[model samples]
Target: MELTLTDDQQELRRGARRFLAAESSPDKVDAAMKTERGYDPATWQRICEELGWPALTIPEAYEGIGLGPRELYPLMEEMGRHVACAPFFSTVCLGVNALLCAGTEAQKQAHLPAIAAGERTATVAYTEPSGRWDASAIKATATRHGDGYVLRGHKRYVLDGHSADLLVVAARAPGSTGENGVSLFVVPATTAGVTRTWLPTMDQTRKQADVVLDGVRVPADAVMGEPGAGWAPLARTLALAVTALAAEQVGGAEACLELAVEYAKVRKQFGRPIGSFQAIKHKCADMLLLVESARSAALYASLLAAEAVEALGAGGPSAGASAAFAEAASSAKAYCSEAYFHCAGESIQIHGGIGFTWEHPAHLYFKRARSSQTLLGSPAYHRERVASLMDL
Candidate 1:
């Protein structure tokens, strides 16, 4: 299938680019990074109102724009390019994906509309102090009390946890262990027993928090999907997240490459532009190749994910569809992470002393690239997944 963006998609990209350039200035980025919440609430609200970004992926039936992955993918890429500091990724991509995939009709009706309207923010709390992303790694316990569940556990590195109005938490129920006992619960952040503390991270623009759930109580209806069936939905959500992240990586890599290229063309050495030198030219060429390759991979994986959703709805796995999507997703994540890291490092190297200074934007991209590489899973982790999928 062709991967080119439609005219409308191009327009969307241009619009996002314009908005980021106009609103997300260097000063704004720096200020947001130092803030307690990692972003300005008013600015975030403006982003939602201006771009309709938070609702891009939500279906029209839920008051969203009703677009699919193909349309949403480019917008994510633009966000990455600007290193736009916001909780859109945490709430819209991850949390919304979980709800859409696993939530019952009542759950969807209750939560999705608010999210689509950008009136509320949400997140999924799964990683604990151990930092494992597996469903089986959950240690938080949710015990049945009367007709409800009481949660008692701590989660570390919960993105936007401090600011989220709602949280989808993963916990082990009663006597269940491993994947069999894990369940997802939706808890209001304002619940009496829920406490949140912000965590300092290398990428300060993106906030993370440590959450303490002390006998947090919720109704049984809060459980997403069927009890003990959390793994399948979580896995599917992760695959989609990997694809979105890959698109983000592509945007970041392209931005770094552009910055490096523009700098090289203007900066002179030996009475000649630095870009004229073979070393710099080779680096730029490599960066371009890497970005293009990453774009292809990200787009392919996203299409595969969309296709998988469609096929699953039609009753059975489409021959090799899941494996293809997994492999492409892993390949995109691993390759783009490594590629962006290299591009960022090289961009800095090309800039010499100025690159090391705090004044330059290269370091920001570098830090984001490094941090994002380890977000869902590291390059090494994804490579292992790719290999396992291939049975090699």
Candidate 2:
């Protein structure tokens, strides 16, 4: 696979960085994070209207831009570096991916246009209070009743759930058992008996919610795919999410390295620049190595995912092909997670006491790094998945 980006891809990267630098300045991000909604509606609208970002990866048949992960990875990197407080991650990376992976023609027709137009915000509700990332760990149930299903149970750590108009939920359907029985359903957030409460998070820039579906009922058609057969699609969606997140981690790591180097060149101790000190120089070198390594891993994983999608066509990939993409995704996620946190910590160290303050963006990167490391799965969890894929 080619590691170098094409001219069009490089142009996309440059445009993204320029746009984010102007629109997502640190002060704006801080203000948005401090608010209850955690993002500016006007800014989000502009992104959709001017940049057409939300449609970047959705298929054109659904009125989307029909781009692939190659375009998405660069945009995610820019967003991460800017610590952008937007719904892109939840709405595009998780929600849109779920629809692409599992949504039938009718379902895609119903949802994708609204999403591509940025008229509706959506998120996937997967993890429960158990906090396990495995499909079999789902305890939320959708019990059949007449012509529909009644959903009961809570979903935690739902990204953008509090503001999302649509929720793609994973639940255990009646008459099915274990992971095999798990199915995906689309529920309106305003549906009766549904409660969304924002959670206190360390990374305020990216908010999460606790969603309770207390006997919320929906039509049988709410199911995304065949009943009791949602695991494969969900798994594929998660592989895309992992690769998306890895790209973000690489961006964050690069930002951390930049922050450290810029500070070290200016901050002085004992009548000399601290960057001249062997210890600080070594730290910056290590951060650069980490950032570049993570970037390559993330980029390669994204390419693999996009290629797999192309090879398998829209009907969905074969089991072996899907597993191969999943392995690459898991490897990238594992390495990038640790690398981001490491770079963030070193950036803080290089910045001294200022890094700990709330006013400084260093703390923001640090918190985001810590939270993102465990979002889809912890580094250790992905490592375990990688080992399993290797038959270790």
Candidate 3:
């Protein structure tokens, strides 16, 4: 497929860059990170109500702009470059994607409009304390009770969980086993028996929460897709998640490379710019290669993900095409995660002692790189998935 950015995509990139530069500067990010909410709600509202960023991928039928990942990727890249402290990813990418991929029409009608209107923040509750990413590893249980279901379990590393208005949860339903037992549910975060606790994060800009659902009850209609069949939709949603994250990683890597190159050009050592030196030049060259290659992989994966979303559209995909998209997602996630971390480390090295200080934005990107390496799943995890998809 063509990995080149179209005219409209380039415009999106420029608009996003301009907006984020003004609104999400390093100073602003630092201040927000120190706050209880981790991001300014007013700024988020501006992004949604004014820029319509949160509506990028939501369907128009739900009062959204009705775009896809092809349009969303460049915006994600811009957000990554600025380390934007917003719930855009967790809400738009993770939560919205899960709903669109699995939620019934009634469910989407209920939540998507609120989300698109900037009235609600959303996140998915999937990972447990065990930290396993597979559906079969889910331990949260949903038991049938009267005309509803009672949920009892804890989900860890839930992005934006503390403030999210809606929580899309994955839990094991009674009378099913293994992957088939896992079911997706739409739970209001403020519902009785639901408790949220903020987690200590390496990257304060991206807050994660521990959500406990202790005997929380919901109507049977809370189920997203068909009962005993959540794994398929969740898996597809995760593939899209990894693809979107890869795009972000590539963007961050590109930003780190830019910072290093700029610093090397002006930071003189021994009466000459460090960039003039062979060692520094080689480091920059290597970083450039890593960033460009990762960008290509991320872009291609994004295209495939968008196409997959369009083609599948809740009904699921043909086996071969699904396998192909899964492989692309795994490859992009594995390579981009490692590439971003490498570039971040190299940027620090090129900046010497100054980059190591907390004052520099370099450290923020470094921390983000480290934390994101395992946010959805580690590079090793994605690599293993790639192997499985390839039948290696």
On lDDT, the leading prediction is 3
In candidate 2, what are the lDDT values of residues 268-354, reduced to their tens digit? 999999999999999999999999999899998999889876864655567787778889999999999999999999999999999
Over 4 Å off, model 1? 312-319
In the predicted model 3, the residue pairs found to clash are none
> Per-candidate TM vs. native?
0.96, 0.98, 0.98
200-221 in candidate 3: lDDT tens per residue? 8888989999999999999999
Residue ranges of candidate 3 with Cα displaced over 4 Å? 174-177
In candidate 1, how many clashes are counted?
0
Error of 2 at 86 (Å): 0.5
lDDT of 1 by residue, 1-392 (tens): 97778899899999999988876777778888888788878888887786788888887778888777788788889988998888988998789888877788788889888988779899989889988666667899988899989999999989999989999998887778677877888888999899999998898868899999999999989999887778777777788888889999999999999999999999999999999999999999999999998899888888887787666556635558788988988999999899889899999998888999889888889999998898888999899989999999
Listed per candidate, the RMSD to the true structure in angstroms reads 1.5, 1.1, 1.1
Q: Tell me the lDDT of model 3 at 203.
A: 89
lDDT of each: 0.86, 0.91, 0.91
Model 3 lDDT-worst window of ten? 173-182
